[model samples]
Target: MGTKWITFDLDETIMQNPFGKWVFPEIVNMLKKETDTEEDILDLIVSEHLQRMSEERFLEAYDWDDIITGVAGNLGAGSVIDIERMVIKHSESPKIYLLEDNMLDYLKRIKEKGFHLAAATNGYSKYQLPVLQKLGLDRVFDEVITSDSAGFAKPNPAVLKKLSDDGEITAHVGDRIDHDVLLANKLGVFSVFIHRALPAEVLAYPIDERATHPSFIKICEEKWHKENRLREMPFLENECIPKVVVQSVEELAEKIGFILK
Candidate 1:
């Protein structure tokens, strides 16, 4: 057999979007001019966006302009907002942090174990490249494959197949079952689901517990519920299922070590 390889999903698997807290509030402010209540506007926009993302068909279609326009139309706002400006502003500020404290060290150890590492993510290189740099992981991966560069996205096996030309992909690890796990399964590779709990900071949106907005609290609760529901749902025979599930980088390292063995 050729050298073994292991692929990882970038967002939410190894990285956390610390800047996501600003997105909802900024969007709420932008829509406030067209709407009366900021709370209702926030709730409606978040709910609509999440609903779209939950659908499998819309997985690769993350067009914020379309999503924002749809939300505005639902509110009878007539698409007055400049969505292109908003998307550009947020897309450029792609800040990310490691999901775990020891993630960098763990990745280094994995590299030391002689397995080829690849970042098989569904994002533009313009955005993901800077994130990897910021986290000091730009040089860690043997390959960093992005949707923009690969001409496709996960759960398409071709994205991962690009890395398998000279090696055998032993396993793939990611937080999303729909994308990462599905992609791994398609390639007949072991899938490791990393189920990290939502951070308290993300849940503590609007940043003030004393003046907590009902809409913010509701959104957080609904997000938690949806995450749990996705995890508990039964996978159909046609749907992809992970070979193993892990909750932390420690468990992930152990699992990968076992796979390599």
Candidate 2:
């Protein structure tokens, strides 16, 4: 057995994206349905604005008048084409996710342990990278594999293979079993599940070990979806499963500390 590399998911495992992050899909779904009410289309933004404290601060700091002008200018409000400034305003409202408490420190520790790190996420690189940049999250990983960047997304061998190459000791950490863990298993790397708030009965596989504290799923409220929870999957018929089932990165370092030796 060789030393392993560690791969992490972005939104739930290491950071808190408070802007109805999971519900973005639901909002997009409304757009897909072509809902008539601007309110209905933008309800997620309003709901999140009223809910998340970080976003409330973002709203307060934004120059409302400048925002209005920007929206008007960008959409060409007076042009022959139609415009929905109200909906646009809600949609563009500085949606953001911040670092988990001391997560940067944890990441640095990971690097110090001499493990190669990569980010294996299934979302927007354009949107996601900015969040990472804001929190210095970008510094943690030597590589970042976004589904979009990889072209085929998660549960796909192409996306997983980007990190799997070069013989790094790679393990996948993600909230979605279907997307992240299952995909990692397919690629022959170790897997770890965060158990973001999923019912035990709901899982497709028994999580290698369940995290009791700092349940990352609830911390992000994405626990309702499969995003916050991570399921450490067992080795497939041709793969290997990691022995460590730790609550935090610190413990992961300790359990795998021997690798450094």
Question: What's the residue-level lDDT of 249 in candidate 1?
Answer: 66
Q: List model 1 lDDT by residue over 128-150, tens digit each.
A: 67567767777788889887688
Candidate 1: TM-score? Answer: 0.67
Question: Scored by Cα lDDT, where does model 2 land?
Answer: 0.51
Poorly placed runs, candidate 2 (over 4 Å)? 1-4, 18-39, 42-99, 196-244, 258-261
Question: What digit string (tens of lDDT, one per residue) describes model 2 on residues 1-261?
Answer: 444578887776776643354334443443434434344434443434323222323222223233333333443343221122322322322454433466677777877776778887765465456566666677778888776677665566676565556656467766555555556777766666554344443333323333222343343234223322233333232222222234555445545554333
lDDT at residue 121 of model 2 (Cα atoms): 70
In model 2, what are the clashing residue pairs, if there are any? 4-169, 5-169, 5-170, 193-230, 193-231, 193-232, 194-230, 195-230, 196-229
Taken over the whole model, the C-alpha lDDT of each candidate is: 0.65, 0.51
Residue 243 error, candidate 1, Å: 2.2
Error of 2 at 84 (Å): 17
